[model samples]
Target: MSATTTTAETAEPAPVHAESLARLLVAGERPPRPNALRTSLTFGWRAMLKIKHVPEQLFDVTAFPIMMVLMYTYLFGGALAGSPTQYLQYLLPGILVMSVVMITMYTGVSVNTDIEKGVFDRFRSLPIWRPSTMVGYLLGDALRYTIASIVMLAVGLLMGFRPDGGFMGVAAGVLLLLVFSFAFSWVWTMFGLLLRTEKSVMGVSMMVLFPLTFLSDIFVRPETMPGWLQAFVNNNPVTHVAAAVRGLMQGSWPSMEIAWSLGWAALLIAVFGPVTMRLYNRK
Candidate 1:
């Protein structure tokens, strides 16, 4: 009995190899490289559903434009345009630009919230293209922008504001605004990925955006501003976008301003797009 016990004690268990461990991990897991278009559509639908469930998420888009048109047209209209109706013609386009750009910060906030909640991790674990997540968010946010534009324009129309550019011009203006808004959103996207918290992302976004919107010719003509401020406003990309919209809607055909706005939009996308993606992958 002692000899048998000694022989048993000398016996060893089988060693596990790296390949076996890998196979174990891979077992019952189908690597999920889904089609990119399908993945984007799937995630986009999810974003839309989230908005539907949390209807209050759109309060800013729905209510803020109306308030801005009313308040600005009433309070500043008489002073700026000599009449509220006249001011509406000038202010509507700029307000539309400002409103859409303002809402882009929400994109950063939303992305940051998803990261903090581990949704991005879940997305990575799946076999879908990583960019599909951002594409979907942006596609869904496009609908939000459309809603804001419609509300703003409708309010302006009711308040006796008319766009001399007619329907085609209005369409062109919308297209340009959307293009700028999408490109500008990349700035917030990078911030959301790099920042530690959603609050920080929002704070930083506001700090950057407030200056762009307020300092530009959004409310008044740049000529009325101080010389230094006029120079800054003239160079500000927001000012260019607003001028483009104004020219389109007011039948002034601001071709130069439109070209400048497009250039700025392209620059923003070229610079921030890759940086945001790099940070996203690192995270």
Candidate 2:
């Protein structure tokens, strides 16, 4: 055979490397690291951008706490708790918890909006880690919760609701409240992904939280409740969390309440974190 023909015959196909073979097998393999910080920052910045455009949503965080403090102090303060001053002290913690819980609803609503708008689809199409979106949402929502907590605390202070436990104690209370809110975000995240509608997630989540808040020791002492409801209230996670906050703020360490609240937060984080992640993966 001629030299050219021999060379052509001797030529062989290129060897396939393991990495390329793996890529071919997987077909559109995602990046090994999702750059969690970048995704979180992106998600958080987008949320802030929305807030900048709307600006009114912050009103709820800023004004509602003040309004609640005033409404409870003036209207039912005297009748329920004998004086506005004592009522302010007694009710402020509950108001703080309520404010934090209420703000978390925004997480679900925002997630639902993203899903409905097909933003999540684009995210999935990218090389981003699936879990990063959820983590970013939780981080962003926590910032909103922190803002709401600060606004409520400021309003409480202005309304004569002083923490007898001093600044450190007050800070501890806020931190616990944020921890609980962070754990609760998982449930809301699951709802957002599963429901895919802001109204539905908001309505259902609020309805569930309304009972937990009212039935807990937030608005009143558990002793004041009926026997059956009191049992439930005493056992409710919100009750423990609120009691823990009040105890911390008053400088009276309620160990049992604190333990229970922390336990519940941990349990919620463990259970709902995986569950919500699974739901997100399924989607």
Candidate 3:
């Protein structure tokens, strides 16, 4: 009877070990393949649904762009760029770039809010693809950015800022701007995850973004700046992005600017994507 008891006790551990092994296997399968495209689309749709339900978020989607267009095109366009017409032509591209940059702050804010509220923890417990959550958020945010871009463009058109590149060129410019914004979002995502509060994410992102935008040739030609500032502006990633947009809108060939913008975007994505994912997994 003692011998039999020993055997049963030994056998009990086998089931426990098997259960543990199974759990480990499940944990190993936690993230799944990144499936960025699929995840982004799903998240984008989710964001759209949220907008549908709330409706008020569209206020920024509509009002901010119109206000920015009018303020820049009428209020400061002439003072900054020589005349309202010429300035509108110049300012439109910068405003578009600014709109894209400004919209990404919401990405960080939303992600931070989710993290703080234990929403991400709930998501982690689900059987869904892990990166899908992040991708979905980004995709939905991109839709907001797209709407903002359209509003800016429409207002620009109303202000007599015709794109020399026409529809195809304008579309290309918008596409590049979105890609750049998407890539830049990684840094903000990292910030959102690292920071304790959504407000911190907003503050840090804006602090970083302000210098990047101001130091670039967004509002004026780079050569017009002093030697040191000009050098920095010439090398700034925002400069590359802004120049690429300007070239596309103005019907100018943008091979170099495009290459630079894409290079920066790709580099940022490579660096921040894995880090953000690791942080997410830890959370």
Query: What TM-score do all the candidates reach, one by one?
Result: 0.87, 0.85, 0.85
Q: Which stretches of candidate 3 lie over 4 Å from their true place?
A: 1-40
The sequence of per-residue lDDT tens digits that candidate 3 reaches over residues 16-132 is 588787888888545565455765676679778988998898887789878887876778766787688888888889888987787788788888987888888887886667777
The alpha-carbon lDDT assigned to residue 31 of candidate 3 equals 58
Given candidate 3, what's the lDDT at residue 212?
Answer: 92
Model 2, residue pairs in steric clash: none
Worst 10 residues of 3 by lDDT: 28-37
lDDT of model 2 at position 40 = 71
Question: Best by lDDT, which number?
Answer: 1
Compared with the true structure, all predictions reach lDDT values of 0.90, 0.84, 0.85
Estimate, for each residue in 193-246, the C-alpha lDDT of model 2 and write its tens digit: 889578999898989888888788777787866899988998988888899999
Q: Compare candidates 1 and 3 on TM-score and give the better one.
A: 1
> By summed lDDT, which 10 consecutive residues of candidate 1 come out lowest?
25-34
